[model samples]
Target chain A: MRSHARIGFVLLLTPLVLWLGLLIVIPHIDMLLISLRERISFGVYETSTAQYQKALTEPLYLRTFWRTAVMSVLATGITLLIAFPVAYYIAKMAKGRLQQVLFMFCLIPFYVSELVRTFGWMILLRETGIVSNLLQWTGLADQPVEMLYNDAAMMVGLVYTSMLFMVVPLVTTLESLDDSVIEAGYDLGGGGFSVLREIIIPHAMPGIVSGCIVVFMLSLGNYLTPTMLGGKDSLWFTEMIYNQFIVRSNWELGAAFGFMLLVLSSVIVWGMLRLTGRTLQETMG
Target chain B: MIPTIPQSRSFRLVYGGYVLLFFLYLALPLTVVAVFAFNDSQFPSLPWQGFTWNWFFGDSDPQIGVFHERGILRAVGTSAIVAGCVAMLSVAVGMTNAFLFNRYEFRGKGALYVLMLLPLVIPGIVLGISILIASSTLANGVWDVAQLDIQALRPGLLLVVLGQFSFITTIATLVITARLQKFDRTLEDAALNLGATRLTAVRTITIPFLMPAMIGAVVVAFLMSFENFNTTLMLVGSDAPLTIAMFDRLKEGSTPLLNAVSLLLMLGSSLLALLVILFQRR
Candidate 1:
């Protein structure tokens, strides 16, 4: 029986070990090695930091990385602000059936692909799109306005794409908060704003931290929204990675950028967790 | 139920308006996309000429519908195949992972668990690129050593399936493990005590109980694989999935035909999402 159990354990463990080792662990380590080397000639290579050096020195790469990071942080912040009240209402205010329905509505858009969501945004924000037509009809603008290709449009698309991620975590955490706790704050002469600041925010910190992490990562690594909505000059760092890998065939530089992005996102996520007094295991779980 | 706090009428009114506008913002873009799919216009935007099914059904020059567009149709089929493959593979691996985590006591178990969750946090683009670089390097090494070529290591549909499976399996494992954690061990123990072998007990009792979550994981995994764009973009070769194909067409600018495709995607995914939610509710 002991021998049989041991064999059964190995049988179950083999696939998982292969899946994680081959797909997750080995590839990342290989990428790190690739990034650390330079292709000296057609078939020869030398170990060097030139790829990382280029990522630092090149104005385009540096600027785009900065822009992507800043924009991602901004997008996360905006999503948190917008999703809080809605999540609160659904988690606390709405009645049982309505709560479920409202949450479902929040999830419906996300069920569709991000490409479709981006397409929907394009249809609404293009030069002759619905919003432009509405504006002209209301005499706000005599000529059609091209709203699709810009940073603001990109931000809108990012926020829209990331809203559900933020909402789900926030709702989950907020729903778990005992109602009596909040009632206690109110009964103890706490005003709405005070209670929220002192009680609700503290309680929802884990949710806020987790939601922000997911949203920030999504926004930072997002290739579709920024590219389509922000036009050719989107200057997104992920696009730079894409260009390097596909167009330039510069895998070394692309690997470097990829690592930089991984680091940048990790730092932000770690910093956010630290500030909120949470751990990766805790927040993710 | 007691209200958390007393609110003034003005506060309630303002909050109500905010909530109303919030839902509108969520609904507006999808509504426009769905509506414009039927619009009889060259472009997807503005000035609805009239209602028409030409975008979905028209055939011939300048009016080829999505159904007739061979590239779009092929991409849809490719996506379905890739999604089905990914769903099955991820579920199989995910169920095993659940067992490994739940049923065993091993060293580094906590570390392995965290490692499993690592893919979830890693950016999808990075995952795709790493796999791309790693596979090519592997292919090059094999060629150098053995003078043999391997086409499967190159970017293609197989890579796409593998790339999606990398992360989707994490989610799948998480979902299945949740259901498994709730399972009563005593039932399996009872079966064992009743002269049943371990395999038979699991096959008849444990597997049946986990069937719902396993099905839910399938639908969830399928939706994720079908909608995956970032990783698929990196690894896709000759065959483009629907998202990648749509992206290319959008880059060249699109007509209402694309909106027709979007509408169909919306309906299909909504139905799948509903199924997943129903299973979860059970």
Candidate 2:
């Protein structure tokens, strides 16, 4: 009977294993191999270390890497700031149907595509857009403001896109916390601020760290939002990779950039795990 | 336990203001796009001339540029077909994988489960570019052997579906696996103990229990495929999906047509989500 069950399991996993091997593992191995190769004229790749050397030495690549890192960190921080209070309120204050309704409102944006949401921001932030028009009407500025294409716009897009990811985990973690812990903190002569700092934050640390990891990883890899909102001036690292492969047709250089991004993010994930003592799988749930 | 509610008016004002601002930030962009979908203006921006339906169901008029483009409609059709195929393939594969992982444990099970999740961790851009290269290489090699031209072996629909299936299946598998973990094992055993064949037990007991999760997985898979941009952008050949078409149009300076499309897509997805919610409730 045990053997039969094992056979059934193996039979079931056969397709998935084969599919992953062909579509994921093998292709990744190929990407690694291509990264070590040298790119010749007309976008062809030859095996060499020249591309890797170029990627490491180039100031453009290094600058873009640092810029993306800073942007991702800022975005993650901002999202956490905005999401924490709302998540706390929903998990601790609201009850029953009201909580569900509020949560649904928070999740409404997720139902729409990211592209559509970003386009909406584009319209609102444009020089002659609604936001600018409102500012002008209120006599806050002499002329319509140009807030559409900049780092600010990119940050706004990233934070807005990642807020749900931040909120959901936080609410889940906060909801599971023992209410008596907070009550005990208060009974022990702790004020609201002290209770939050001492009891709530520490208990919710896993969720906060998980949310930060998700937002950072997403922002680091993001190409669309920065490209659309930040316009031509935005030298995001992923955009550089896109240019190398798509525009410049340099496959080896693109592969090197891709590999670097993979390694950089892997390190970030590792550091996060080390700091929080939580794996990616735990955070995902 | 409910904490002490803030009774001060100033506290209410501050908290309410923050909530209002957050909602406005979230909803304002979508509202702008939706409103512009009704605008009669040539451009997507403000200064709306009047409300108009010319963009959506209008006669071909090159002068006003009010007509629906045939190209975009074709792209939408292509997107629907591709998304449908991807949803079906991913759900089927994911259900099988989830059942395997949840119901039984065997040697190498842990390794296989981790391997299944590998695609989800990798960024979409990396996946897209790698799949594009691999498929192109395979197609080229096969063409050389078969004495056929590269054009003869179309890498469009098949490759796109295959690429999307790689990760989308992982997502579906995870969802279904979660649901399966909550499944009652005694039901299946009871059916088998009642002299039912093993296949019958699975078909009658296990499948019915999994049906809701299977449906949810399908719906989620469809949405993921429909909104997929990165992988589709790389793998797509001559035909464009809706997202790619919109990207191309935006690059050339957008119009109300893009807003119209967004509104339509938003409505469709919300309605589908509503349907799924209704089904789950039932």
Candidate 3:
């Protein structure tokens, strides 16, 4: 190879490789060591799996583990149900400028920070919030109904936060589908339900799976939303990890819990890929 | 859509209402955030006392508008600094990877690409802790080997920037390389055949085509860095970004001033989205 080209290659490649190595690889390996060992004193330690054992055996941790898993799955399902019609309308039914405008309507709000979005929910859901105030003003109720600080509120927040991710992918796949196929099905004496079930659903399958994976992963790892919306009672697994690191300052346990969360997300993602048969490359976009 | 077929009445009513409500759900929360920023009441929610610009321009004894709040302004400045640096660094690094790995033949190139993306797939909370673990260990290793204090090496804004850059660079790479895949190699070959150097050909032909994606990537990286909370919360020291600053204020029993900040941020983000929409199409 010519010297200039070789030099150009090294200069180009070194930063990325060094960055991934130093930050991504080295840290996680260090995290493994931290999780495996108990700190004896400042800057001293012995290797043990006690943190993982405690995480597995403790009721709070275990309950939180299941709760996070179930909640994330439920949130993913809810987001899918809400996102599908929106994606369909934008991708299949809506025409020209209207399509882009409506889609942007969905996309713009998400451009706001998740913190801002969650706070918006709090403002609307708190006992003295607009919903309660409106309810009382119209004599629908005598008292302000506290809507925030509950599981259902948490779900609403999660669904709102994650709806955009699902919509984009579904639109991508749905747009690729031929309109004539659906028209043909309708001409063959098929009802709307049969046409949709037989044609549209199958065609949008990859998009659906991809959307679910992204939504699931996001909801599972989310900390700020549940903590803010669900109050202190929120049992999100990420919160458990946050408590370990921030509140308790237990690095060992935090590392262990972080590792556990990683494992859970990875396993679920792998299982989803197997079921959906999507390559990692296709889904990454 | 083909726009040839018409829908049934029931179909139109149900799906139309559903879509309208869905948009309402998407938009209502943010509208509330914006509306409350101008609310005269101390608290953001209920019975509108009257409209006031206090949250934006006016200042009272205790709570000043976000524009007048020094602390919030400082955090925004800090956030801008961090995000600007992250955008440049991630784009530079992402461009490098896209050209070298995607365009050239190299052993372990596939594996390296996957490794770069591992950060993207993993929960950012986990990535943040891992950075904390790795950096502290590196500090200790420095202490042991060189007998140096290296207090500057501790977790701070630099660490936070690096931690965010680690994955955001991956996102940048994905965007640029997706553009790179559609590159026409014949142009380079033609340029080389005409006695132009490989570097010059790349600089002229390839890089110009990549301008759109690179700009998009920089925009995305900047936004990601700006709004980032999960990973950043772990690596930060005493210095707080806007998200952390706002969260701290909320946790301390916030007032309408918080809504003002939200309105400003939402406006900034909406403007960015508008830029992307105008420039790039799905």
Candidate 4:
């Protein structure tokens, strides 16, 4: 009976194992193998880091790689800055029904696909877009200014896309702090900034780190937003990877670019977690 | 200054300004998407010529509404089918995997749990690349070993479903596992002690308890599958999902017809989420 139960448990676990093991693990291993080798011919191949060397040494690839890293970090920082006050309001200030409605308000658009959401931004920011028209109408600008296809536009899209990931964690951590703690700090003659520094921020550090980590990782590896929002000159690294595979049909080169992104993200994520003293398990949710 | 003081003029001003600005930031773009669906302009952006329902319904030159747009209905149909399959399958796999977690004490379970969740953190683009490369490479070997149709092993709807299922199943499992954590398993043991078979106990007691979470998982999986773009873009064959369709239209110079499509999707997702929120409240 015990053996039969063990068999059943094994059976129960098989699908999960088969899925993660087959689709995720095996494929990534294959990709790793592909990255290590150079394509010699149509059917022949080699084992070398030539692809990695190309990715590392090529100026365009290297420049875009660093640019993606820097942009993602900047986007994450901007998202955190914008999200904190909103999260604080929702967590601390709102009443019962108001809180629920506010939370839902933030969530409803998230249900809209990122493609649609980004498209909405496109509509609003394009040369003849709403913002430009409004600017022209109000005499703020002489003619239609191309508000889309710029770094600021890219930053806007990144911040907009990553807002919820930051807000959710911040709210979760902020909600747990007692109201009286802030009140006590204020009563003890702490100014607003000091209270924020000594009481609120320290209390919310875990949430802040988790939100930043998630947002940074997301924006770093993101392809669609940068492409659509940034237009032809976006030069996002993921686009480079896409070009390597789909455009250039260089699978080995694409694989190498992909792992480099993986390493960059992983190392930063690790360092952030260490600095913040948060565990992988805690930050993930 | 106190962060919260209704009496303080500066505090009220700051609070009101912050809330209004942030809410507008969140709501304005989506509002534009919905509003421009009726814009008479040929271009989807601004300079709204006049209001027209033609974008939603008119079928004529320069105004082939979303309904009449070529390949759109088909893309929507494909998205629905794929989402439906992904939802059902991810839930089934998730529940089964949750059983593995909830009903047993085993070695390496912790490690395996982490492994299961690794997909969640890995970027969708990387995940897409890995699956596309590995599956194409292994297709012949898999076909030979299983003696299945070559098409089954190829990149198609099946591959898309599998790629989505990998991460989504992990999510479903996590949801159900959270439910199971608070579960009193003694109820199952009690049922067995009372001479109920294992299957009977699970069917009557465990399943009923899990039904809510299972439903939530199914809803989440469906929505995620529907909206998924990055991973699906890489894995997609000749056929395109709505997202891919929209991206294509962007390249082709789109019309307000795309706005109609976005509005419809937004309405559907909002309605579904409303139902879920209401269901949970009840």
Best by TM-score: 1
Tens-digit per-residue lDDT, B1-282, candidate 1: 125466777877887788889999999888888999898888987787899999999997677898899999999999999999999999999999999899999899889888888898899999999999889989999999999899999999989999999999999999899999999999999999999999999999999999999999999999999999999999999989999999999999889888899999999988888777777677
Which candidate leads the pack in DockQ?
A: 1
Collision pairs in model 4: none
CAPRI level of candidate 3:
medium
Report the CA-based lDDT of candidate 4 relative to the real structure.
0.86
Residue B134, model 4, lDDT: 89
User: Which scores greater on lDDT, model 2 or model 3?
Assistant: 3
lDDT of 3 by residue, B1-282 (tens): 235567677878888899998888888899999998988877897778789899988777665888889999999998999999999999999999888877667788777766877787789899989998888888888989999877655768998899899899989999999999999899989999999988899899999989889989989999999999999988888889999899999987768999999999988987887787678764
- By DockQ, rank the candidates, best first: 1, 3, 4, 2
> Model 1 chain A — which ten-residue stretch has the worst lDDT?
A276-285
- Give the TM-scores of the predictions, in the order they appear: 0.98, 0.95, 0.96, 0.96
Candidate 2: give its CA RMSD in angstroms: 2.2
Poorly placed runs, candidate 1 (over 4 Å): A231-233, B1-4, B280-282
What residue runs in model 4 are displaced by over 4 Å at the alpha carbon? B1-7, B140-149
Docking class of 1: medium
Q: What is the C-alpha RMSD of each candidate to the true structure, in Å?
A: 1.4, 2.2, 1.9, 2.1
Ranking by lDDT: 1, 3, 4, 2
Give the best candidate by lDDT.
1
Worst ten-residue run, lDDT, model 3 chain A? A276-285
Output the TM-score of candidate 3.
0.96
